[model samples]
Target: MIYSPPRQANFFMIFSHGNGCDIGTMDTFMKILSDELNTHILIFEYPSYGLCQGSVDINKTTVNNHAERAYSFVHETLHWPTDKILMYGHSIGTGPACHIASTKPIGGLILQSPYTSIQNVITGLIGFPGYLFGNSYWNNLETMKYINCPTLFIHGERDGLIPSEHSKTLYNSLGHIENKQIILLPDDDHNSISYTMSSSCVKSFLKQFFPPSNQLLPEINIDPEFRVPPETIQTSSSIFSYNPFTSLFNLSTVSINATQSVYNSMFSNQYNNQ
Candidate 1:
């Protein structure tokens, strides 16, 4: 996935996924996200996918690949500083998110529909004991000890495959107060969350953490007062229309907006690309 954060972006987010989702799923998400966050979003596909794809040898090893890809995308491609990115994940993606959070000084972490561990999920689904499953994601009781970033966990209360209890257990283990939040929405099942509640929780989480890197990224100026893109608004915008993340830091457009929906459609199309 390639993300261009208006060339002035500093705070970016990157992720990996569960078993079946592809870049296309991630693309739709980024489009919705771009409505609020004007930052870069990257989603990576694991080795185990389409018929010809290679097998994922180790579940835990995924953390390493995610970190490497995110780092490369941030530091090399986006030309942003290392300490400015946030880490986000969904379901199986949490393994890698927790791994990177353990090692990096992330801006924040947003985890949606995460599993406690691979063994826990497998056991829940297959009725097989953890000892019987050779491929264990053993993440349940493990990653919490290492996650150092401000964390937000969102889960579906009625999830059948991976219960919301997994999120509760991790949220309880947090060492601090301001650093954690666990939210479980009502009537939300695993596969259908996006149509119900995931988007709002995502906005809230991003609203909270998006400020940390405001200084590092350029803010777009949409001050109705300034009628034009002041070249001076580099690194921070003089306007406020494009991102609330600007005001979140306690912060856009005309030629880009005179066409309104056309620009939105173009931007939406661009943001959703993997």
Candidate 2:
């Protein structure tokens, strides 16, 4: 799925979503992100997630392949220059985002609720080394050595699912990169960071690197039907409500029932133990 602003965008972001939500659930958040940053965003749907049809595979290789295809679509089909593309990933998506940023030439990178490696996450959770059972999947700490672009890592200091130390470790790993930053939200958790502080952080980060073009463009008048009702927009203290905007876009036709179950299994240690 793609979201473009009314004016020509200076940079484009290839977004990889986290577990438990598909493109359908992410529609409102992405729209708000596109509007706030005034940049085009292309969300890559993993296999068997959203409307994409294929066997589900969440390993680093499969997810990285999907991310590469999304990158090619933007570079080849959309004609966006490689230097103007930004990679944004959340949660499990950070694996592919790091892979792409390390191997490809991108403007910048944004990682939310990231982990050093899948093994590290399990080790932290179960008090056992994750590598003892199998190979390390999505070893971002190793991948960070190759990333030279400006990067931002966001995490909730109160995150219970993936501790804040994961982002801290990743931030410390990028010592060679001058334009790197990490933001820890005091009031946020693993899932609340997106709805609470992400927009402001993203906007500030873009201004530092990819400022908009000097030429002025006419203001865009959002159609009434597409404009989210003011009452529906929640304050920082309230939970975000997606019910109002759920029917506005047809791009999320795929059912999320199966996707949710798959995500739960992937994250559960019980499945890993088997």
Candidate 3:
């Protein structure tokens, strides 16, 4: 489990990641979110992923079981209040998030680069009918109806693999959920949303529940190596107008010097190579 202690924490988060990623891949991302929101975060490794020993089955039952175990550890073992817990799922992680929230009480839920269902994702990719197999693996679109707490959806506008439409449809499907917001990052793809703009969107979404008492803290530095190239700036499935560059510099807590230093390092390496 990964955790970040806050000066004055209002909530704790249980974070689940996507397929092929373990806690190691999410270390920095989780830390960034924890620092920005000033909350303790618990990142659980799926069965067979990372050091957790279990079958590598990515089915509904196993994933839900993992979510249950993690929640129990935080709620039963750690004794955190039920209402003070938040669930965050990214990509395939949305499966367990929806599974747990469908039956449990949580302060809120955050799904990043989510899918309607794993079956839907497969159909969208291969053009094959998912119903042919009669599987309902990770049916978040259906499970969402049972969630009454605040919900936040973050997706990449240029996400081709799962498409932003999946998240849009999921949002629309949550008919009576008044406290829900969908944010689509224009310049990012499925894999880049967290580093690009997840923090800003999360901070805004969390404000209604956990109002900021302290000034925005300095941001954790993102790896400079993953900068988006200019050539890939294509339009995505965004219904809202967005400018990524402005968002990057206008962050509530990110330092101008740090941003500049990242750019300087990138440019210096390029110049030296030339």
Candidate 4:
């Protein structure tokens, strides 16, 4: 899914969604980000999620391959400049976002509700040896060592699933990057970190890279339509509700699967040959 603001965009944000929701579920959120930050957003689905075709496999390698392909499609085919592209990942999506940021050239990176690694998350939550269950998959701590670009980490201080310490650990690991920041939302949780909750912080972070034009002043308030009353905000049980591992703890159901090409034919038909 792609969301382009009415005016020309200075940057492109390649977004990787969490394990639970696919592109279809993130349409509104993507639009909100694009409008608020004044950037074009290209958010893709993992294989077997949403309209993408394939069996469900939520490992680091598979998702990184998908994310790199999306970056190539944006840069090589769609012709977005490498330095003007930013990567944003949420939850499990942060794995691939970190992978691409470490390997590819991009202006910035944003990680939301991120974990240092799947292993660390498992270890922190259940008080067991993480290697016994998660291994080293999606290790953002190791990946952040290679990332030199401006990076922002966002997490809910009240996040019960992954915990806020995950983002703090990742931030501390990126000590070499001068332009790094971490924002912890006091009122948010795993599922409550919506645009309304972090819009100002995100906009402030983006301005350091893409300064607002005269026509687009900074500090503009979020649209009323997008704002949710604090009273209406409710924390969910978990954002990993669709993950298979959660089912082992009786938290949720099995992952979703589907049959289709790993790369959507739309991109091949329209851009691959171009």
Best by lDDT: 2
- Residue 14's C-alpha lDDT in candidate 1? 71
Model 4 residue 72 distance off true place after TM-score fit, in angstroms:
0.1
Question: Where does model 4 exceed 4 Å of error?
Answer: 55-58, 134-136, 212-274
Q: Tens-digit lDDT track for model 4 on 1-274?
A: 5677777777788999876666766767777888888787788767655556545554556668889999997887777777778999888888899999999999899898999888787655554456765453678898988999999989999987789999999999988988988999898888887776556777888877556544431222234533221221122323333453452212321221111222245446878688
Q: Rank the candidates by TM-score, best first.
A: 4, 2, 3, 1
What is the total number of backbone clashes in candidate 4? 1
- The RMSD (Cα, Å) of candidate 3 is 16.4
Q: Estimate each model's TM-score.
A: 0.69, 0.76, 0.74, 0.77
Per-residue alpha-carbon lDDT of candidate 1 for residues 1-274, written as tens digits (9 for 90 to 100) = 5444445554567765554455544555665554455566666555433221344433356446755776675656656555566777777667777777776666777788887776676455534454544543447457778766778888889987678998898888886646678889777866667722555776677666555433645334333432211121122221111322121112023322343555457678999994
Q: Which has the higher TM-score value, candidate number 1 or candidate number 4?
A: 4
1-274: candidate 2 lDDT, tens digit per residue: 6777776666789999876677667778888888888777888777655555445544557668999999988777667777778999998889899999999899899999999887786555544446764663688899999999999999999987789999999999999998988889998888877653687898888788665666433333334543332222211110011222121112122323343455466669676898
Which residue ranges in model 2 land beyond 4 Å of their true spot?
211-274
The 10-residue segment with the lowest total lDDT in model 4:
253-262
Prediction 3 global C-alpha lDDT? 0.71
- Model 3 weakest lDDT span, ten residues long: 232-241
> Which candidate number has the best TM-score?
4
